[model samples]
Target: MRRVKLSDQIAEDLRRWIVRENLGPKDRLPNERALQDHYGCSRGTMREALKALEVEGLLIMHSGPNGGPEVQQTSAEIASRQLRQFLHFQKLDFKHVYELRRSMEVALALNVVDRLTAEHLTALEDNIRLCENANNEQERELARQAEVEFHDILAEASDNPILVFICQFLNGLIRDLVDYRAGSLQEHEAFGARNVAYHKEILAAFKARDRDAVAKAMDEHMCCAETSMQQLDAAFYSDLLSRR
Candidate 1:
């Protein structure tokens, strides 16, 4: 078993305290010495704990005589970025991501099917146009990102905060995998066309407010995307092996 650092433990306690106190942005913590006294730790340990929180974006550390740690608004992007960074060191693969998405994204779709506003609908429609209009490699890359944004638009519409956060993170992972992998423009063009077709079907279901069709279409879409991602992963690995 791994031993936990005292500094880490205190940082966690501080996090819980912030939540319990309902602290908001710009809320200041006790002075360095005061916090040091409260945690009964040495100056080094206290500084490490405070720095951890700062790295997590939970607090903004100010220096000097008038300086201390102040609370900051937590962001989904921060959490997602942290998770993505961690996953980079793991043996995670394309299928691993899709395994979660195949089910979770379906739920996300159903949750937001009836919640999307006219603005949301417009954004979704506009995104498809962007995908179809992509011509160059740079433009095609942007289209791939916009494809992810289509789900992000749905994710933002869902009332379930947890669902929205996880979906947003998964979308980030998808973007990284698809954008960074070795692929021919011909392959991407095919994948892009397939994605546009699926998005169109999903949008039609949303417009008609058909829950059954939405669920069915979304599952099929994820499955198709998984296959395309598998091809990309194979190509990436093959290219890596050739270099050996």
Candidate 2:
């Protein structure tokens, strides 16, 4: 095995210490000077290690008298934001994203259909009501969030933590790329109406506990979204980019 750098080794050691000590959120870490001396590394090496942990959302570097690096638990929102940035940098196409979503969501639908409880059904209905009541752009944005929450509830009802995590991450990415607020009110209503209808279909399948129907509904829903995104891109290209 290739020898790891001293700085990385130091970072790993600190990570283990945090876990072993069961450090809660915002627990202050040792000062830089102490870490440098304890690890037998230069100040720069210690700083590099700390910075690595900070980037991973495991530590927050604070300044002033009341400040130091503090341990932090990672949130799904943070992870999704970081992943969205990375995907944006890569310039991922809509088709690639759609294919990935279809595969994951279809599987998730099949897995969750039989497992949904009455409580989950009520949560989904609440989201649908919110979407129906959405009037302005701000309310529409809230409705979009509710839509994501509705799907998240289904993913959670599947009793698979990994699937729930992946679905939430993708849902955030799609929301960011779509620019829902940039469109007109009519466009928002059109999109919301279609989404509500498709969700109802999926919910019906879930209610009946039909795995194949759930899979079909999810696949169709993703295809509709993919087509809508393509149309939006075409309109954008024609109206905005072509005018330039």
TM-score leader: 1
What TM-score do all the candidates reach, one by one?
0.93, 0.77
lDDT by residue (1-244, candidate 2, tens digit) is 9999888999999999999999989788888887888888999999999999898888999888767789999777778788788888885656767778888899888888777788989998887777778735667667666666777777778777788888878887767766632352246667777888888999888888888888888899888877876666566556666668
Model 2 per-residue lDDT at 225: 75
Worst 10 residues of 2 by lDDT: 177-186
Over 4 Å off in model 1, which ranges? 1-3, 64-66, 135-138, 182-186
For residue 237, give model 2's deviation from the true position in Å: 2.4
lDDT of 2 at 201: 93
Q: Measured by TM-score, how close is model 1 to the native structure?
A: 0.93
Q: Candidate 2, overall lDDT?
A: 0.79
lDDT of 1 at 98: 96
